[model samples]
Target: MLPQDLITEILLRLPVKSLLRFKCVSKQWLSLISDTHFRHHHRHASSGVILCRRTDIIHHVSLAGSNSDYQPFTSLCFIDDSAGVKILQSSHGLLLCCSNYKLGKARSYYICNPSTKKYSILPEPDYVSVSDNSSVYLVFNPTKSLHYRVACVRMCSSSFNSYQVEIYSSETRDWRSSGSPFAAPFDMVFDSGVLWNAAIHRISPTGASLCFDINQERLGAMPGLPSNEKWSRRRLRYFGESGGRLHLIEIYGCSTQFQVFEMDMDYSSWVPRYNVDIAPVVDTFPEMLRNCIVRNDFVLYAFSLLCLQEDEDDSLLLLHIPGQFVSYSLRNRTFKVLNSISTESNNAFQIGCFHAYQFMETLADADQYL
Candidate 1:
């Protein structure tokens, strides 16, 4: 038998799937694999992407390997039989999901680690008003602490153009109100907040954005893109965090050529990182070109930026065309098909039909701090 320290070093290099199966070798191996420190080390060693379909099915896609298998998680059935559930956001290795609102049942929220097949139901927030709209985002950094937090942004019911923030801590296992109500644009939506730089960033449809610091419990305005007359009516193609960096892509006037900008650490300005022109990709896959007439002259194509992966050599951009996912290389300017969607289902796999979420496999326990 090998030394215990040597065994641990070898085990850390293994993938989460193999580590899970190796737990059955012996009780000692099981205990070692389940150790909090072991799991934290393993999490930093592996990373992947997960696509959340319109039907609420989560599919895992490997990032470093050629295996693009879709693993459906049927073990996520924790709520009542009648209520349906959908994922709201994903951070680190944890997922934030909520029960679909039904006529008689009160809505519930959940934080789960699908890799371990473990989940915990979160208690409802204190203020639940029928008239107010609320959005909850997941905040977790396994490297910092074992516990996670859920930040809720809800519109104030009594005051117009005012919003309140509430935080739920896994360590305390309870919800508490954060700072006082702050004013923001009435049309600013908080449903799609992205976690980056220890803060939750949200961009509104009208180009307004805000950032809420998790540690300081403060909200402030996020710097906008550089001003340009030509890009005045640009649409936000993508806004997400990848590899500890925040990226934003905006497309203007039905053009395939655009620039991907990376925000600075100080939130000062956005610097252009990648100049992408997917005209070749659209030409290769002609079916992806769905022309929409805008004001009878301009034409718009159908495509969605799924993910942006940063690496030392070449960064990759994941895009969704009607039924397929394509990977574009930023350095080489090459394109490859990552995965194809099946048309067997009733739902059409179009641009707006599905959403993508980054999934990193880890042994982070759902009930560790609870």
Candidate 2:
């Protein structure tokens, strides 16, 4: 047998399932498996998938790549049936689920490692307001640090004078004020901010703008959208992060196309990344999808995944269709249907609940943060 030190090294690099099984080899192994240091090492070994809840079931798919064979994937969700909002965000392999139930009368959030089925419910924040739109974001990366923090941002648009920032620290096991940094307003309805380069980039009600830095625990402004661009409400515009860079995606124009831009590391400029024409793409795919484009009234929602290292042609765009996920290649110009995602019913409301977020798998436990 290898020496215990050597075995520990090997175990740390093993897959989650194997590590969990190795716990049964002996009490010593079990203790090592549960050690904080071991979990940290294991987190570095595995990168997680985006978890999407389909009604009661959770489906986790690779952040990039097409489901050419229609292989199915499903993970059990421990969420209470009464839960609402169903917003899923990930940081350091842990998923932060912010939900509003009881008809906006109450708010509850959960942090869980879906791989291990270990979860912890967070105490309600002090600023739980009558407005259901309280802003929250997660900041945790095992590679960079062991600690995790959640930030809730509120803007006093009445004046560009200041914004309220509250932070929840795992070490403190409670939420505290990080103080007002700047005056900014985020249109939660249109802007789904993403954490990149240690800051939460949000936008104004007008469309592509940036604000909030959870790590800095303050609000701030960002450069304006690319010069001479018309941000029409007729089109759907959203922001996403992939491969360590932030992206702005605009889907509009009479051509029914998608315009994607990648932000520079310095956050000072934008570069055209991909220009996808959906009409030709629909002609190349299934009848149902083709009809979505031909009918002219069908709505499209997409979840962006990083450009996969293996697929050179393009970044993967996961189309949010009822009861299924369709992967569209930005470069190679291909489309594949994801059959692994199965819905219990075809109800439009239930289908609308299916939202996807990129999850980076890590061994970080929610308990350690507290």
Q: What is the lDDT of candidate 2?
A: 0.60
Residues 1-370, candidate 1: write the lDDT tens digits: 9999999999987766788899999999999998888887784444556766532455665554455553524235554335777788878788888877788777777788877777877777665632226888888888888788888888887888888888889989878888888987656777878889778888877777888887888987778775463444667878999879999998877688999998999898889988899999989888766544364345567778888878675688888776677888887888887655445431444576767777777678876766
Task: Extract clashing residue pairs from model 2.
Answer: 48-361, 72-340, 170-369
Worst 10 residues of 1 by lDDT: 72-81
As a TM-score, model 1 comes out at 0.91
| Deviation (Å) of 27 in candidate 2 | 2.5
Best by lDDT: 1
Q: What is the TM-score of each candidate against the true structure?
A: 0.91, 0.77
* Candidates in order: C-alpha RMSD to true structure: 2.6, 4.7
Best by TM-score: 1
Residue 175 displacement (Å), model 1: 2.1
